[model samples]
Target: MQTVAFTQMKDGTTEEYQFLRSLEHRYIRSLPERLEGALQSLGSGLQGYQISRLEHSLQAATRAEADGADIDYIVAALLHDLGDELAPANHSQFAASILRPYVRAEVTWVVEMHGLFQMRYYAHHYGDNPDGYLAYQDHPWFVACCHFCERWDQAAFDPSYPTKPLAYFMPMLREVFSRTAFDPAILQAP
Candidate 1:
């Protein structure tokens, strides 16, 4: 395919713009594969947990699937910790950003705020407030986020858990990411 020749966006012609957009569409289609690769890499960093980060993530998704979560929710659970390697300080927000355009706002919100919700489980060990999540208690999705963290995220680290392999989720991941981002026809939070 012919490529855009402009060094800057302002100089691009209409044809070039269309070309770039097509390229972007193609690249977006590969998001699921990219996410799977990222999940695989999670095993390389941080070691305090009983299982690898990849394992924890798979277990979380496994549990979510077992609980009959929708594809978007299960995929969200699978990729929720993907940002840990790149943005440990704000991993939840990073993951949420990735999911925001593809999933429901509530799912994105849950992913975004799960880190704080998860703190309720063991934050006291680090001298942090266990009830810090209470700050968001009145939000409509608070209960859902609480369930996500309590039932899936926080409880997914068991070594003996029957976590499905990453390959098991690839098809669902691809389907979730295949959605038209920010589609006006779909319901989403403003």
Candidate 2:
């Protein structure tokens, strides 16, 4: 039970401390410290911290864990965009493949839904036609994530919250890494 308490995030003004808690507490403990470490080293969920998909994933994971979702669901939320931070352009499928070994269909669905969700939201909000939106419904994960996103997005920070540009985020990844797991050491390795 390595309880790590973290300070409030970049978008927040308040100083708060709460231990990182997960729903499948027992399983995570035995999975290897590297799992959490790998997740922690991941930083802002994408290569550039400013992108913020990963930070959002952490927030979403924290929310899901507290809500008592299953382990697969918990990891899915935590790693929903695990590949996003790496290849922002082609990450959805990459993330799914990366996680295939460690998780199950439930989590995989969420990962797959991310693209559909973003596509549909962009089209519905901007484009007049729903040609792209219609395709999203065909993805079962899209439906599940839509419902889940609705619940947690309320607490998600603004995309530009840290008041810094995307380029600056890469440098600040140390800050991102440090806060995620409440340990600065994870930022040491490549």
TM-score of each: 0.95, 0.50
Quote model 1's TM-score.
0.95
What is candidate 1's CA lDDT for residue 142?
98
**Candidate 2 wrong stretches, greater than 4 Å:** 1-38, 41-54, 123-133, 136-142, 153-155, 158-190
CA lDDT, candidate 2, residue 75: 55
lDDT: worst 10-residue window of model 2? 169-178
Assess candidate 1 and give its lDDT.
Answer: 0.91
Candidate 2 versus the native: TM-score? Answer: 0.50
lDDT of 1 by residue, 101-128 (tens): 8888889999999999999889999998
Worst 10 residues of 1 by lDDT: 181-190
| lDDT at 40, model 2 | 56
The backbone clash count of each candidate, in order, is 0, 4
